[model samples]
Target: MPELALKKETGLKKETRSEELLQLVVFQLGEEEFGLDIMQVQEIIRIPEITRIPHSPDYVKGVINLRGKIITVINLDTRFGMEQKVHDDNSRIIVAEVDENVVGMVVDSVSEVLRLPLSTVEPVPEIISTKINANYLKGVGKLEDRMLILLDITKVIMEDAPSKVAYC
Candidate 1:
């Protein structure tokens, strides 16, 4: 008699190994690295000229017109309680969807797209740096030499602000 094999998730017979992986768009802030679920990322682009929003917190970098649509952008540095750094050639804006809204977040640089087994992601640990709100972290992704701080996009975008932005 032959033994039947099954995939770890989804009781269906295994066809290919591709569906069992998690994808992430990795980026950097100051000296730390972070990641977001790839599905939340729309696109990444070079930092553009941003128009200041009056009375808004310093973290709110402002807005930009991307292909004729105005999108609000924020500074990840300030949002994480770090000193704001001037935009350089390596800086970029990662456009993403959070809670049904579009937002562009500035990062030191956009790194590579990482794909790994879903099991490699672990729940948020008890202690982390004080700069970012732990509620904003999805989990800590374990990699070979480093750990990727996975972000909860909705919280990062909606909670860490002067107030809920009223962009239409």
Candidate 2:
């Protein structure tokens, strides 16, 4: 419910425009396409300096004081077990609120927000013969050779990772 509330706060194009389908904020994580429920995103900020917290989880990049509110930041790349990349010009922070907790995830350049019909949203593929974790994906959105990995943001952040991340 909070996620839905967050989406409402985003002031994304009205659902009526998409015929009641949820709007998806698409972005790039490495070479893959990822989508987030537009409502969950609070803001898109250019990547900022993240102070690493000693003894914290490897995926936890650090914390940021956003308008006086301390928010934990996560490196989605590390969380997803991908190679960590230095934040650059094309990098961004997608601030999303989940269950009242707002966290920022580092990502490659953001693409665009598109309307994804719920009917077109299918379950994630069962083959981890693939490159990503199925639990993090809600489904795939097909678009003329490009497939957007529809993300279940809460699941991606809240669920136990498929494997433990080795701390550097």
Best by lDDT: 1
RMSD of each: 3.8, 10.1
- Model 1: how far residue 94 lies from native, Å: 0.2
For the record, the alpha-carbon RMSD of candidate 1 to the native fold, in angstroms, is: 3.8
- Candidate 1 per-residue lDDT over residues 84-114, each given as its tens digit: 8778999999999888788999999988999
lDDT (CA) for every model shown? 0.83, 0.78
Write down the lDDT that model 1 would get: 0.83
Determine which window of 10 residues in candidate 1 has minimal summed lDDT.
1-10
Clashes of each: 0, 2
Worst 10 residues of 2 by lDDT: 159-168
Q: Which candidate has the highest TM-score of all?
A: 1
Give the per-residue lDDT digits (tens) of candidate 2, residues 56-166. 777888877778877778888987888778778999999998666678888988988888777666677676465457777888877656778888888777676422222
Structural similarity to truth (TM-score) of each candidate: 0.84, 0.79
Candidate 1 stretches greater than 4 Å from native:
1-19, 160-163, 166-168
